[model samples]
Target chain A: MAKNYTKISIETSNDLKPKDETIDFLLNYSKALSVLKSAKVEFELVLN
Target chain B: MQEELITDATLVSSYIKGNESALEILIKRHKQKIYSFIYSKVYDKDVAEDIFQDTFIKVIRTLKKGNYNEEGKFLPWVMRISHNLVIDFFRKNNRLPKFDNSGEFSIFSVLSDTSLNAENSIIKEQVEYDVRRLVDELPEDQKEVLLMRIYNDMSFKEISDKTGVSINTALGRMRYALINLRKIIDKHNIVLTN
Candidate 1:
């Protein structure tokens, strides 16, 4: 096995969850999710 | 995550049980955000609206019969539709619809005739333009994930599922996307309040 030497940066997982910003362009994305749920068309999953 | 699951499951289940009104409530609940998400990708109001209506229409058909299993993330599922509709829109015209290079979801929604009375308070117009420019500079993959995750407010897991990649890959893409955006902003000497 060839040994390689290089400095590597590593990260440990933490409880830092991303905060949802209200001002980002997607401020209204929740409502989009809602609209998809009540969409007006129906289809068969084409289950094969 | 728990809250989204609960709400998604509730709305989907209600629609499944022969309640048409439930679907209306669902549409009313999501119109702005979904419209915003679709418009972000398509960038034209008429085209976006058509694709949006088509997405929901497909959803309706998906639900009318005993098709949906009700065991999936509803938002992601619908997003899959929006994404597919976007592709169809492109393919139908024999051209791929690439998103605007700027990551900013167009601010046009905020600038309509009624903009003076809206309640959102955050970034100003200049910052929005800067953010959009930075987003536009991203590689397509990173840009797609960022749009889905940030603009669509999808979870990493959801983004991964929708994009057909592993969760770690999705996370990596988003991490790199932010890093690139920072570089772009600094390179351009743009300051965003975000």
Candidate 2:
């Protein structure tokens, strides 16, 4: 994470923001995405 | 501040190097633009949300595989992805009508307005049901953590207390649960959106 990271949210044309559910889902999914990538790196390290 | 000084290219590289929260900052910074782009194309909130999620999924996959080399052009690159996904949504629902080019005009495709109606909503429900069913296939501990966090809306500390584990352990289970769910989705080729 970058230092001094602040949560700056923006809304859409409908005058409504993206749902909290959607934002949470994306953040969680991104964390999971990085996990698999790191796991693969570990696997390759063991292979070599 | 510091975040504003950190460019998208820097965030992209941080995410590739396994800093997950960098991706979160990236998503939050541009979510409004991307979400609005999808919503403008689809004209439906649910459909726009689904496309937004799918766009990030594709972005994460590309970055994880070290295939994202667009230099500092992150916003445009992501906008192009979201645009393609909007097209995919239209293509999937046959919203974009195909005209008959064989001299005669075709009314069938025009009349085939298969937009989000009652029937489409039913299909969407079925897809959600199928996803929940797949969640059952995760390992016991991971499934428990996922159900508690997602379905029950419990915080990690609360989950840790209930599950008799450290907070870090609970978080790990949740992360592994999500990773396994993605693998299951891929193996079953389940398109989460209708």
Candidate 3:
């Protein structure tokens, strides 16, 4: 594999203060919207 | 997911009353997991996107027809639909589903079970590494079956249809794959006792 991240997990999201797995999850959730937006932009560019 | 629109059950209630924004908000909220679940299944970036869209279309149709029974498990319900569509995509294509990269669906997320014991973190990492290593070396048939059953959580029936195999054969493949995996673990002498 290109990355050995299978072995190392830095626990970036888990902390004593707070973390946003939920927000991170939402960012992922917004992926479809971003994809739709980009495809629309590309189509508009092509039309223009 | 409806992170914004689903401030509470009230929004879903409004959604049930025929609100478009509520539906869109809900979709945007859980889009990533739905997409990842499908992408993980079919192992195609493009197909994942297509199935993701279709899933929402089904959701829209379901909602419009007032067929949404509010069980409060919105994302899981949506994910189930996305999962089925991805499997259907695999069925139509007549090809074994392969992970786009052995590492494409990174173990980080899968291993991100928040309850991971810090003391056993190293051991956990080692086990994960070894498991992944063995999984990588598995034959294409075994690897795809393992991924679908374990990762995608698809039922055996779903797997049979997706892989174009009979149900008995699908079960048999999984059984043999596990047997082979056990041999590999024994050969390595890596002890992970439950």
Candidate 4:
């Protein structure tokens, strides 16, 4: 006789909350965008 | 002399042959995106600038040593080097993200007693759940690009190289991901922030 196996899987998204990692990423991304914008201006200035 | 028409590979080859201006033109051509990529990870202007300069220095050294092999994909190659350097910086500084598994670790846990009401906490938690679920609903390719762009701070070019797709395809996936996410948000009336 073949052995029987039972498998159970649980999916949980209800417990999700804003992670510090995501928050930090957003903050960093915003700052980086500003820095890049300023750098572009400075680069243009030097080129001119 | 149509200098602007020179390709990255040509500029790199010329630089390798001791034409210093070729390297300058190469740097000038790709510095903005490269700098932006670095800034996305470091988040500090001074630090990003330092890494940006260091990335070029390393690139120059590698090119001089005849180590850089990706001729046509010079920008993507350099961006990979920049990404590695950012990782190294984080490793050296011990600044990598950490997850606290303790039950007490939560956004609400940091709030004052007066502000830690159940209603507000539930709303915050729901918004986070909805946002994550929406992201999960995205197609695999789009989700991959979205996560890489957001979490890994990788540029589209880097995403393309990593995912083995054209840059345009990677960018298109990201665009579609955003559009789909927006549609989901609107359909669910998901409020992302208070």
lDDT, each prediction: 0.66, 0.81, 0.65, 0.71
- DockQ of every predicted complex: 0.02, 0.22, 0.02, 0.02
> Per-prediction fnat values?
0.00, 0.43, 0.00, 0.00
**Predicted structure 3, TM vs. truth:** 0.39
Better of 1 and 2 by DockQ: 2
lDDT of 4 by residue, B1-194 (tens): 57789988988888777777777667666766776777767767667776776677677666765667963499888989899999988989766554554444555556547764888899889877877788899999899999999879999889999999999999999999999999988988877984
lDDT of 3 by residue, A1-48 (tens): 595556332223122111234334333333322111353352211110
Can you rank all candidates by lDDT, best first? 2, 4, 1, 3
TM-score, structure 4 vs. true: 0.42
Q: Against the native chain B, what TM-score does each candidate's chain B reach? A: 0.45, 0.49, 0.45, 0.51
Question: For candidate 2, lDDT tens digit of each residue in A1-48?
Answer: 779876443342444447878888877766654323454463211110
Question: What would the TM-scores of all predictions be?
Answer: 0.38, 0.49, 0.39, 0.42
Q: After superposition, how far is residue B128 of candidate 3 from its true place, in Å?
A: 47
Docking class of 1: incorrect
- Interface RMSD, all candidates in order, equals 12.0, 3.2, 10.6, 15.2
- Give lDDT for model 3: 0.65
Window of ten residues with lowest summed lDDT in model 1 chain B:
B114-123
Error of 2 at B3 (Å): 1.2
Where does model 2 exceed 4 Å of error? A1-16, A34-48, B97-194
Worst 10 residues of 4 chain A by lDDT: A9-18
Top candidate, metric DockQ: 2
**Tens digit per residue, CA lDDT, model 4, A1-48:** 997785322122222222334334333332222111353352211110
Candidate 3, which CAPRI tier? Answer: incorrect
lDDT of 2 by residue, B85-190 (tens): 8888888887765566554557774577767899789999999899799889999999999999999999999999999999999999999999999999998788
